[model samples]
Target: MPIVDLGSIRGPEGPQGARGLPGLTAVPTDQGLADYIRAGKDSKTGQALDLAPLLDKPTILSNSRRVYTINNGPWGAALGAVRDGIRDARILVVSDSTGQGVGGSSMDSFPQRTSWPSFLAQLMDDLVVPTAHGLGIPKSNSSAQPYDTRWTLGAGWAAGATYVGFGGKQTNYVAAPGSGALVYNDPRVYANTYDIYYAVSNNATYGQLTAVATGGGTNTVQTGSQSVREIRKMTVVAGSASGNNVVQITNSGSAGNVTIVGIEPRLSSQKKVIVGNASVSGSTTSDWVAYHDNTVTNGWNAFSYMSAYQPDLVIIDLGINDAIPSAQASVETYTANIRQLITAAESAGASVVLKSMIPSVAARAAREAQYVAALDSLRYPFVDLFNRYGSYEKTSAEGWMADDVHGNDRIYQDEGRYMLQALIMSPMSLAAKSVTIPALPALPVEGWSERWRADQIPLTVGSDVRAFMSVARTALKPESTWTPPTLAIGDGGRKVVRFNGTTDGLSLAATRTQPHTVVVLGRLRAISTAANNGIVGAGQSAGSRSSLFVSTDGKLVINAGVSLTNPAAVPTTTQVFIGVFNGNNSVAGLTGADTAGAAGSEGATAMYVGRLGNTGMAQLDVEEIIIYPRGLSSAERTSLTAALAALAK
Candidate 1:
């Protein structure tokens, strides 16, 4: 008979198999099994891997723009690029004789009439289609001196610039009483169409110039024409004063507004116009004003004046005078003053570049040190001109300066290039990466125990125990010709000792046994000369030998043989004693009262259990004395002896 095949003989088809539950394969794909393993290993090993250490350095952020310090003279071809806006650079050229070493010479006649500003204007015209305007001198009828409007017109022609001109007197130009006249105002006269009218005359009152349109109907003024509109109705009162300049400007029309966009005075007068300078001197207190009225008075007062015109950037080059020993105090004052000024400029929305003072051999090394110190103390972004221009000794022959102290025009120009490079590399304009500190190693847990051992005491347990045998040999000894006591184990696994040396025929037993590990920790002494034949247990003295026998049941008598014959004759002090560790594991509990058998002793048989009760395991030793508190059971006794045997090893 053929065996039935289960599948072939199936009576009916089984229901469709239920879908199996998804397994670990369904877990998030982003984290694979390897990641889980790594995380687990990290947790078990207690390793905190800092991902931050793997990141790139931190960056410092800044919003400051670039500033270029140009020479006092021509800027050449580069000026065109800057002016043309091809290079969006803010150029600052120092004009005062102090900057040019002209010794109070006028900027126009400095031999380089095509000065840096002129070159800059030309550059602006070539590069930037809309050139910055120039400022013009204020015109007054009394003063016929040429206004030198060329600088103004050049600046304007280079780009739509404005000119800020200073006048000898306060005079207003009007278009012609009622009719708006043609005022041939050259765009070149001002850097832009807007010009600031500055009055330098103290005696002049507000004077006006008017022009009636000759052609009528708002006659247009010719470009670069020197036509003048009539002076407006006003008066002049002569006044003799040091700071008597009154500067104000009105729009071309009575109703038309005169928007004086910018005013940067070329002269260095602290009491009057606000401009950057090495120093300013004037009798009138009002000559100086804080840029944006920051109210910080110092060397910055001069710098702040230039900043007030809303300059995009400022170039601060100082420290020459600061190097003088006579000017040391002044240098410090100047440093603090400049710092405040920098803060003010920053507050007033201008980026400042402080140029470190150049090195000089004027006073030799002392001067250089002072200047260097001042620069080092400054926190603002700065260029090290001293280091860049080579040392005084190194560059002296290369046209460094003829005066030996002040730098020449060429040096200034070279320094300007250095300053430009520094601006590009300054921390203010760069990003600084973040820094990381490594974690420290873990400390050992047993450090406290090591600290204790250094103090000269030894504490130990088990295999780490310290031997006190040396202490006993030096501090205690039997009487003359007495052999040292043999240290050995006692009954019940307790520590004990046998003194076999001569002791004046007197026998003493000392045992150390506590529930915790027993330690023969301190020095022990044997006083064999004492006439006392007594023993102390728990502060009580034992009686005589006749009563010392144990019970038939083997219970050892505590005070059984305690007796004192001729008690008065026997010295009442000496007694057998034993030391035990206190409950807290400290040996401090052994006060004078516990010094066994002294005066006021509670008899030799009264054992002082250290107030810790019988929780302490004990050891008893005698000159072959036996102790059976309750007659140890045969098994218990055997176990005790075995423990003692093990301890002896």
Candidate 2:
């Protein structure tokens, strides 16, 4: 049988090779397999093997499930690497002088730059706190109140005429000759000795004044004669054992209406703020910027010292001082400044954490609430210190503040603990959550292969011509003078290329005579105010070819066979998107203008950017440019316009 069978006697394909290993229910392609592996574990079994035991610490899953191996080293080496990373962690503390002991003394244990950095250093290593002292920003000493006292009634009340409360009308407190005149009893005053501010309205009576507080004899904090409407601040005594201090104001010479507008304990000089040094606190430095009457002025971004420090997290504890009546900063202005700060900070590669302004004194309670409300609406990592200790009423009752503007040690400690948690813990990864990417409009299943990104192109510093990607691969050839890629401006730290109008331009190799779409993200230079500033063009001259330019009226114009108008103006400072689609029948353009066009023919030879051949030289800055072989659909055009608009912002 063996001799007879041989190679000539083969069976009929052996039942199709036994069905080829069950036909793989799902195909594992590059994308498919990656997604599957990311899902982890066998779906049917619903179980996962502990690969760490077989491999090592920080194990990574291989491409194939069947392949598994141990790491090159032991777990100790991996842990050492992690420790090094932890040691190199950079932490930045941005706060008022409270973090640097401006008005108050620093805590002895952590007496240095900022107490937060020192405390965090004690817990972990590699913490870097930047020195904010040299930022050249102003500082304030007088505490910032959260409310605007200007909203209260009797704003111009006489100096001697008393007001019942912050919202009260004019009232008179006339004292009998030689009899002590009693003012309102305030619980916030210090039991030992504290400062009291009285807003007197037109005090014309000249008299010998004697001030008294609970559980203390009369002490003359100030002497007033022939007083006008003025704010008189004096140190007075208080009642013993947390009792309300009955403040008495007596004028021996004559009886007159004396008014006490507001009274609260002033921020003490001994109040401890920041505490740490650069050496023991892991290169952290706290600058004392908290001064009297410091508003949210400019120069916040320009940190003089430690300019090289990149903050991992930026804490902004401002606006309380800015909300004061004297500061005169509106909530809108303060919020705008804060937004700018956040953008700048985030742009500098740091996460921002906005701290809510704490409760202010009773006089500015309403204003503080508005400021806090503004902060609450902003989109960022936020810490509600105002709510943490207790809200305005509770804070006032619990005595969590050294003064109306700054918090005591208890508040600072609690805040530091929360901050430490945010720093140490992993912020929930965006990857862990399901991502929903809006699907792009599918290309017409036809020709549209030409693609070019200006940012991706290669160019030399002094080269006359640079090559770019396109259906007709064009190169930028500057004729005489050109500004190279230096000016950069964009959100998210994206940079764009700039070109001078007179001489800077791109030269194309061959004529592109097919129906094509051109997309550009660009902005006009400040100096270029000409009516016909070319953005992207493809032809020997401006009028004879396909091109998009800013017309004399500042609106975008497309000259592709026929001229089409884009309703939006080209912004000089901000970037804009200009798209031109020369279709089979008609040529059109868009600037997020979404304009329609009538049917027309098209003619274009060589391509040019920043200038229309040699005539319409343009001083323009371009961020990105794309040229497709075929015209784009309405959906694709709209989507691209919107996407580019977001980038411009």
Candidate 3:
């Protein structure tokens, strides 16, 4: 092989070497790479790429094959799942406050602590994403708790969610903390980042019930239910006296013995009550006996026997009893309960409205302050009834309430009105109009007989029309019984008018000559032989026998002249009438006849220009009924009539 130095050869570029077979362009592999990544399997190299990046892309799979490709696929799926979970989430509120006073006295505290859970439930109802269920754990420390739980859970299970007890067995089946049995334990619960647990102080008289949470070897108390997992805040507070005002029954009073029990998250689930004593009185043993009797007979629990019916909003009105003592513990219990109620409702996906406790007396303003502080501290929306209706001092005299605690019907109605206004004004409310109609043009001429038809006024050979006319006539005698003349005229190449009636003794007359509309008038005459009977002077006898007819095509007009030869010969009481009729036989007529010897009449007579029959008729005259393609004004009618008379000549 001879090795020629290429640099030396150079052979004039050798004719571009046939273009080097067009360099093969690189095709995009990103699309293919994307597909492989979406396949969710290891690559040919047996190593799987981190799909986290691909998680940014969403893959739509159909028939086991990838279809649509979306960015951030995994994250989107996670978010969607979260949203759906939130939509289906529910919350259960448990209140353990019992009704009691600081001085061992029974009080009319129902559902002890104002039933804050119920109020919270009502608020939740207004939320965009409503709760699947709102179950109240009633009086977890009372005997009713177990029975209520069993009944409520039984219903809940049938509807789809489980029930979990919060406290011990007597009042509730204490489940392991954070177990799946608890609503919080369910991963779906986190669909929303928030959860709420509600508990209340059982006794406002002796010592307020405080939420206890396990913290590094000891129990701790928190202000709001949002802080701990198992521990929740008290939403409602109630109070009653226990023992001496100074030496209270710390934990044994009706208000002191509070607990929380089971709850169901199923749709339409009812509240469940738990164990607790009723407000006590007299000896401690006697009070305990009465509490037991009440629980056994009436199924009384920690709170009152109240239960919810899945209300959209709940209202809590409590703290009056707690404020009586002016004790810090009582106030704390009230505040804690409110906080818990709010949390539970939010967890359940509901909005809440707390009501401020009304004061009982002017001096009780201090108590009201404590109550207001407790409510405000919760940071939930609230309705201040005390402020709305004048304070106790102003409304108390007016009898706003029947008792010191419960409002009367009037007050309740007022409350209802407020609620209604709030609901309607809220963005979530809806309303609609009842009826509507399109507007139409108003017509002129009231009380005038009207008829509508396809107009043939243009009088074309084929056009149809409906004519409506009114005429009034007076008693008139024709000079002779004669038929009107009919004629035809041509306007350029078009057939303008074609009259087809008789014209024996008829005469054409126009009051004006220069381009005037001619009105044809007929003279009526009665034939009689006897001297006085002959043509009895244009009276009813003559008027009834005459008629005028014309075309609505603006080409014709008719006027009938009636007369009575002797005005005294006809009965003075004799009356005459006139009428006009349209093509459709629709008629309008006048009541009085043209008086005899009128200027237009040759002798004594009466005549009128009016509509004919109420609806149907043809032979009639329409007065002032100008006839011209272009409507004639008063001057034009006069001018046109003159012109026609001249043309007739």
**Number of the predicted model whose TM-score against the real structure is largest:** 2
Query: Best by lDDT, which number?
Result: 2
lDDT of each: 0.27, 0.42, 0.26
Ranked candidates, highest lDDT first: 2, 1, 3
On TM-score, the stronger of 1 and 3 is 1
Across residues 1-649, which tens digit of lDDT does each residue of candidate 3 receive?
1111111111111111121211112221334323433443332224322332323322211122111111012112222222344222222222122121111111233222222232222222221113222333322333321222112221111111111122122333221122222221111111111112323222232112232111212122332221111223222111221111110011222222222332222321221111112221111111112232212112122111211111222344445544544443356555655554433332221334455554556555576676776565554444455555546665567665544544443344344333322322221111121011112122221222221111111112321111111111101111122222111122222211221122122111112211111122121122122212111111233333223322222111222243122111222111111222122221211111111222121111232122111111122211122222121233433444444333223
> In candidate 1, what are the lDDT values of residues 97-199, reduced to their tens digit?
2232321123333312222233223322221222332332223222222232322221111111111111112222322223322222322222111213211
In model 1, which range of ten residues has the least summed lDDT?
A: 448-457
Worst 10 residues of 2 by lDDT: 1-10
Residue 246 accuracy (lDDT) in model 3: 13
**Candidate 1 lDDT for residue 132:** 36
lDDT-superior candidate, 1 or 3: 1
lDDT of 3: 0.26
> What clash count goes with each model?
73, 26, 113
Give candidate 2 regions above 4 Å deviation: 1-90, 101-309, 396-399, 426-649
Model 1 TM: 0.31
